[model samples]
Target: MNAYDLVRGLHILAVIAWMAGMLFLPRLYAYDAEQNAKPEPLKSEMQALLRTWQTRLLRIILNPAMILALIFGVWLFWLRSGQGADWSFAHQPWMITKLIGVVLLFGWHGFLAGQRKKIAAGTSKYSGRFWRMTNEIPFVLAIIMVLSVTTEWTLR
Candidate 1:
């Protein structure tokens, strides 16, 4: 394998790690919401545990993975450009679509981070059902991104 292959592999791995956290975090939030409805020590204990898990997942896995994925993904784009790949939106609509999806994923990550802060503060307003519904966002975005890359779909 060559440099491009290596970078692409790393990008994929990092995205996989990021996606794992993206998919799991909201489910954790749902459980946290459920726990919030309980009473006494159990509520406090579960909230603390969930908060710890969310914090660790965000700080340890999600953040690093996202950074690495973005770095390697940009590297791959630069390498592709160097290799004479056309990056024009008209020429590669799929790349544009993939980019939009990635941007949305980044936004979702930020949203989750903000929610984590609210949860830690015991000020979160979202319900378990809300989190459950939002959990599908990453999965749907992943499918769109994968199809965009694999198919190289165009507007025409």
Candidate 2:
């Protein structure tokens, strides 16, 4: 009911939403990639997959989740220090690791979109090798996030 509790709740909720999206989306990509590899014709299936994931879910769900995650995170950080200029944040090893993970996640999302776009137009061949290979990206990013969250180890 208090300000700290409210922000803390929002922060936890946002992290759950964001982590769910990040963790599951990669698996979805794996499913989509396999489904795409089956003899269904690459162009049409690729187009459909790209539109649904890259355009629809990525834009509507993932994008907003990232923003909400960031907002709630900033709110939590502010609550911790009571100031936007809090240098103590830099001293927090977990926050630093999380920040790096977030950066990788952001780049991975954009990279997914770019790959989808490239293969969507039929200009580039829809290669299963390419899809399967790059699909490891989100997983790696997610692991960094997991370690960031659950580890007591410190870099600072």
Candidate 3:
């Protein structure tokens, strides 16, 4: 009904879209890595298919969703600050921890994008197992971020 509420809803929707891509792209990369075990011709074809999927997902969904989420999240933060929310919240231990988690989330996103660049250059070195292992990062970060926001728990 209000502007902040609408922006918050949109931010949640963007985050969901972005997180879905984050969860999926690494699995696709794992499959792409597995393609290395196939016959040469099949490997090339599968690599091409995977590259297309990666490009489309990044450009059409993931990048835009991330941008939207950041934009709206900053807006919400500013709105709260303007409405007299205490600036000291930023220094709270739980808030600091959540911000650290968010920074790591961005770093993880960059690492995955770098992997995609390597794939494009035919020089990726990471294995399917590695990707599978890293896939849990986003899920874990999401859980921590959600819990921090929902519970507003603080270190005493």
Q: By lDDT, who's the top model here?
A: 1
Worst-scoring 10-residue span by lDDT in model 1:
82-91
lDDT of 2 at 125: 52
lDDT tens digits, residue span 120-148, model 3: 89899988999899888898999998888
Candidate 2: give the clashing pairs: none
Residue 154 of model 3 has an lDDT of 78
Q: After superposition, how far is residue 23 of candidate 1 from its true place, in Å?
A: 0.5
* Best of the two (1, 3) by lDDT: 1
Per-model RMSD to reference: 1.7, 3.8, 1.5
- Backbone clash total, candidate 3: 0
- Per-residue lDDT tens digits of candidate 2, residues 6-91? 97778767666665665555555555555554565774666486457745665676678778878887777787777666667556
The Cα local distance difference test for each model comes to 0.92, 0.65, 0.87
Each model's total of backbone clashes: 0, 0, 0
Which residue ranges in model 3 land beyond 4 Å of their true spot?
83-85
* Model 1 lDDT tens row, 104-152: 9999999999999999998999999999999989989999999999898
**Runs with alpha carbons beyond 4 Å of true place in candidate 1:** 83-86, 89-91
